[model samples]
Target: MTQDSGVGRICQKPVSALLFDMDNTLFDLVGAQIASCQEIVRFLGYKDGEELFSYFLKPVHGFESHENIRQYMEERSIPIDGMYEKACRIYETEKLRHISPYPGVAETLKYLHDRGYPMCIVTDAHSRDATLRLEKIGLLPFFSGMVAYDMVNVKKPAPEPFLAALEMMRAPAGDALLIGDSIRRDIEPCARLGIRTVYARYGDRFAAGHQDSGADFIIDGMDELPEILDKFNKI
Candidate 1:
């Protein structure tokens, strides 16, 4: 069912609980990561920040960008002992400064919370990393439950993290909605378990695959979310 408002249209379903992807969905994750990487390279006295950032992510892609700094320094024969450790420290310190929630995210979350809809965060990020980001964004209180990659031996696409969140919230798969950017990681896996899927189209970074097959709904921004939930009377 589609409901058209001034802002956008929400394809509604019976949504009981919300399972959210932390990065990109809630905030500009790519922006924060790129900023941190660029600052790290500059701190290490290198002008080729963007090129090196690409190289660093090419092999071991994810949030663990600092781990590759050591290999990069060694490959270039930069002879900067302890530079890798120092770079990691710098990246960690600066990353928090660069992080914040996307516009409308905080208000939407508060609206959902006040209306008594259970919300859980299911992310393929280290617990420490996820915790820090939530704290920075002031969103820690809105989530009723969280499932982090590090908390489980398996990550997303495995269904373990999603299942964990469902269990934590005591939510049935059919009554829940999983929203995220990745088809491989979030949409497809949750769809396998019969949960409704909402593709956070604003957060799609790679643009490699289509969301058509898995997602039951698609939202371009957080502002569209409340209207979607409105069908469920969350307003």
Candidate 2:
């Protein structure tokens, strides 16, 4: 469909099924993650939050896995599983309580849901974690399904997860559009199946004009999506 939208003659292919990335795409992962890390550290009994953050920021510990963290705690003579469990407990009990959906997300999702769009989430995070993240934010009910890395053993930037979500939704890749923030991961892979893409322009780490400009369309925020649909209407 095409419409005389602000940018130009809008051309949107029919989109019966909409797939999204859950991490930085849905929630502000950088903000939520910073909060979660602080809460987890405090739960581990380091009353001074800065100390734990300091330890974690050390180059060797940066972006370590749960198991790597467990070993890190072990190397310091701390109980591995105990602290690990404590960290996870605090994240669930406390960190989750602080998470907020990005502005306009709920209303946008509701609008799409009300319009009979079959929405689904496909993210690179662990399956269970992405599920819980959505549930924590109260947005899980609007989705038809979800696909995560842990489930498929292959993440986006690889076609596996995106293809899996399309298959789960019973939609062909050509008819499905992958809308997300990451250029390399989301836009490139979905393009493999002739799937179009929409870049969530305000998402984390997005350059004003990214290094690789691959998305078929771009919107600064959820509020602009109605226009995107209008663009779709034109085609």
Candidate 3:
């Protein structure tokens, strides 16, 4: 299945299944989170959204933890009786409202679905959050299953989540292609497991400087996926 088709070499086997990273890959989660943080700050009469958003980037409480909101309030000495809960609700609502699929996501997913490629989501988010985000963007129906942090109790860069997804889909690593935004979390771990990798360059927000992602292929947009798959299948 390896072919030097002028778009990097293809995988060693035809991709029978697709594994997707949910957050940044499927949609602009970082953008949504920023919007949500701004809305939260507005509700709290603050002018800086990044001040609150920084809490999520910290190692404490994790990125998706609502405790970030509590910490933000506490650092400012805001009363925590009912304000914290209201802020959490506002954050969740605004985040969901701002989330939408990237350009050509639905069409590409539909195209792959029509071509009989099974797809599953591999995410570090909780199952409930994953479902809510996917459902919000109307992409829930496209996936056959999901492997979330709750199920594996481990995040990416760890092999557990990807391995769980492969087992749930019943697809061998060589025959599966993993599309994700993070080189450390998504591409490298799956590559080690003998799975082919596609780095979604458009969705990458965390990589500060350009570095090799170690992906078998790199696509700038979801529309380019069909062509990549075509190359893989042509072998």
Over 1-235, each residue of candidate 3 has an lDDT whose tens digit, in order, gives 2222233535446888899999989999889999999999998899899989999999999887899999999989989999999999999999999999999899999888877889999999999999999998899999998999999998888999998999999998888999998988998898789888888988997776866777887787888888778876962
Which predicted model would earn the best TM-score?
3
Candidate 1 steric clashes: 0
Best by lDDT: 3
| Better candidate by lDDT, 2 or 3 | 3
Prediction RMSDs, each to the true structure? 3.8, 4.5, 2.8
Mind giving the per-residue lDDT tens digits that candidate 2 earns over 9-52?
22456776789987667778756546766776665655544444
Which regions of candidate 2 are displaced past 4 Å?
Answer: 1-12, 43-64, 71-81, 206-209
Candidate 3: what lDDT? 0.88
Query: Alpha carbon lDDT of residue 53, candidate 1?
Result: 64
How many backbone clashes are present in model 3? 0
lDDT of candidates 1 onward, in order: 0.78, 0.70, 0.88
Q: Order the candidates by lDDT, highest first — what do you get? A: 3, 1, 2
